[model samples]
Target: MQEERRVVFIGKIPSRMTRSELRHRFSVFGDIEECTLHFRSEGDNYGFVTYRYAEEAFAAIESGHKLRRPDEQPFDLCFGGRRQFCRRNYADLDSNREDFDPAPVKSKFDSLDFDTLLRQAQRSLRR
Candidate 1:
């Protein structure tokens, strides 16, 4: 059976760091498919990174991922899994209570009678 992979969430990556550098550091643990550096239209930076496999992704999480120069102090790092990937952490499971069910979704189809719609349309045209 194919191994289930986890999607790791990484934050606090350095703003000035290049993609190549990010790949090199992360590749030491596993294959990295992509690395994106988010930036606001106003030019402020937000740190984010995604990994190809769960094992390497976990290593990165344990490495105390931070937004800093190699010799600098480490910043806060947050690593979590994606729901689609079937990855769940302790915190994720704990937050949801069994007694609290979400509201039933509304149907997508229009339930109003056609005659009512036609009358509304006619009234708008007359106005």
Candidate 2:
């Protein structure tokens, strides 16, 4: 199966989190290719994050599905986060974004399979 390596968070991010924090939080799944948070003068804010592998993207989605407090509201997470069409109409909007920069406070991910990670990283570099 060809797993999609992208995810989009629709609506406002919980606690008004910025793209920098978003990157840090999601990086635990894997190396992120890009993370973007766009602001709009009207309507809800949206974020786009792309992971290096399908598994990483899936992990991020799974993490977002966890239980949370009633008062806590997170962006609606979904697969297939392409923004090509959305970008065309965003010239007037102010966007907060980053290209895989893990912010000032680095996020430490839990241990992963080193050999598998290494192989995947190398394959990505080639492609």
Candidate 3:
């Protein structure tokens, strides 16, 4: 069986942090397949960041997975199983709870190739 390439991040998501920031933080280790932050409550929340390779995941685990920005709190990290989660789970799990789930902050640049992006940029300049 293929090993799961995911690491569970246990910590509180700072009010300013977004999924893209979290994903970028892990990219140094390897290519990230997906990064989802489950913002449960105010005190503590959890998220799963899946890498493209088990070795990448292992590297992250070995490094202690300590993420530190100049102005953010460190998250507790560990190897966790690959469990699929959905956005609806938030509502289903607790309807009354107020959770601040930040949307994934990916720019159009992330999806566009350089040529396509350059064309769009030129088009914009022409207008």
Winner by lDDT: 3
Q: Candidate 2: give its CA RMSD in angstroms.
A: 19.7
Q: lDDT by residue for model 2 over 45-102, one digit each (tens)?
A: 6677778787777877778545234665655777755445463643423345544354
Give me the displacement of residue 96 in model 3, in angstroms.
Answer: 9.1
lDDT by residue for model 3 (1-127), tens = 2355565454656656678887888788898887887765565666677788878887776763466665766666777743434323433333454685657889858988999989998999999
Residue-level error in angstroms, candidate 2, position 68: 6.5
Clashes (N, CA, C under 3 Å) per candidate = 0, 0, 0
Task: Return whichever of 1 and 2 wins on lDDT.
Answer: 2
Query: Where is model 3 more than 4 Å wrong at Cα?
Result: 64-66, 82-127
What is the Cα-based TM-score of model 3? 0.54
TM-score for each predicted model, relative to the true structure: 0.46, 0.51, 0.54
